[model samples]
Target: PWSSRYGRRNRYGPSPTVKVATPRDIRAFFMESESMPRSDYLSFPNRDTIDDTIADMQALAEQVLLKVDKTIEDQIPPPTAVLEDELPLHYDGLELTNGVTTVFMFSFPDMDIILPQVDIYGWTPDVMSSGVFDISSGNAVAWEDENLRVGLWLHSGWNQTAKMLQQYLELNDARYRREVWTMDEFLETNVIGSKVFIQQYDSFRNAKIVAAVRVPPEGVYAVASHVMDLATYLEETYPGHGFEKIIDRSDVLMIYFCGRQLTGEKAHPDLPTAQQSRFIIALVPEGS
Candidate 1:
């Protein structure tokens, strides 16, 4: 694991050890139904069933991991050094076969359409320019933290959104052979590499993208953000929840819907808890 001592000062205390999901774990997602095959689940599942499918994929991953030969050390070496506030770009690549062909697609979210967001109307300059940007660019599924709770906002429809992304990638996989990337990439530089990584991830699931937020000076704790569009939608959705307003939808700023639900046993379920409360995500090409 890339230690926190390598990055910015630990005023937040020891950085929580975030468990990164491996490529195999991601591959396991596409392997949910042998009858349907990998692409079948990755590209065609409906939203209503996406979450259940994601769970099924996770369960299968656990089984696959249980059979791994742990005694055999990984051939990949860990990073000896890294840029400040950057995660060691370590990776373990796996050939995610569609059981037939491995391809990738790159479309939608024209970069020309996404420009840097400058000052907002009345707020301090901090909101537009503080902390690392877009923590979850290519995250097809939410990750779990050390607390065994989820790491990103997930509600009834987000899983469907995730599956939609998976399907979107499969739709254009006809051009590539394989993919490679790490889920921990954001731990190093949260904002800069997002768009490009997501582009590749969507093309081939090369990177392990997930909902990411930084740590507070007080240290790691659970938090959530509801970056959504439409006034009526927000009014209807957050009827009884307690959350602060981060941003209002505008032509310049795009909003993504993200939030957390209380699990019976867990205290904090939000992933990548950080100092910054708002997580600036990359351009989402598709969603629910």
Candidate 2:
């Protein structure tokens, strides 16, 4: 407001004089502001300081996004990690754990029923083919020392039976005893029952381990099942088979030895298979 004066003021104590704006200056400024260079009147903070602050903020945002992406990436395991645990399950040195209930060893045979004691439900007599054991169902299990290519299921959610087999193969005994029925006994026994499950796999050298397991006709497990025409279902879903009849005379269920599920979904049929997903299912029936 003092700049309104026309005359200037002197510095105090007569230290060399200094001029200060008065009322006249303020009036002159308002009167000529429109014609004056506007930027001269409008001052902003230094440009370098503002630019540095904006750059700092952008860098901080980028760092935050990078950290978030890294954390999410670490949370999931790529499907390939299962390779070691899936094939040629060597139960002799297998570690023990109690969190899972059943275990299934595919790609090998345990006909003698040794090591934790499993009844043979399915066998591949072709020596070159993979064998399947109905290791456990609701807690039944078995173990053996045969040198075979085996995969063990170590956990239980839908496939509790598979976990039971894993426990035994690890040399840890399973106590629950469910009979390992031949297709004849199993079909005859459970045919009238309400719950039925079919597990499909991408069986191979480095087996996919578990392809899928669920109650059929209602869940995604429905991918490959038909009450009578199993061959077509297997071909469409798993895409390959080497079937053999197990129980030749079953009034209720016709059991067969289904061949291997190959390594990859799109892999060639002969590309080193793992589990016998069962085409029509060639079977070495129980007690044979």
User: For every model shown, what is its TM-score relative to the native structure?
Assistant: 0.19, 0.19
Stretches > 4 Å off in candidate 2: 1-159, 164-220, 224-228, 235-240, 244-282, 286-288
- Model 1 spans with C-alpha error above 4 angstroms: 1-159, 164-191, 196-288
- Ten contiguous residues with the weakest lDDT in model 1: 119-128
- TM-score of structure candidate 1: 0.19
TM-score of 2: 0.19
How many clashing pairs per prediction, in order? Answer: 17, 36
lDDT of 1 by residue, 1-288 (tens): 213312323123356333333423323322221122221112212222223476666754554454342444332221222224543221122111111122222233422122121111111112112211112112112222221122222111222332233222212234221121221232234332233222223243322222222222122222122121222222344321111121221111122222221112122323321111122232222220
Candidate 2 local lDDT, 1-288, one digit each (tens): 221211122223344332343323323322232233322121111221122366656654554454335444343321111111223122222311111222222332222111222222211111011112211222211111111212122112112233232222212113222222222232223221212221213221111111112111121123222422332344354332221221122211222221222212232232122121221222221222
Each prediction's whole-model lDDT (CA): 0.24, 0.24
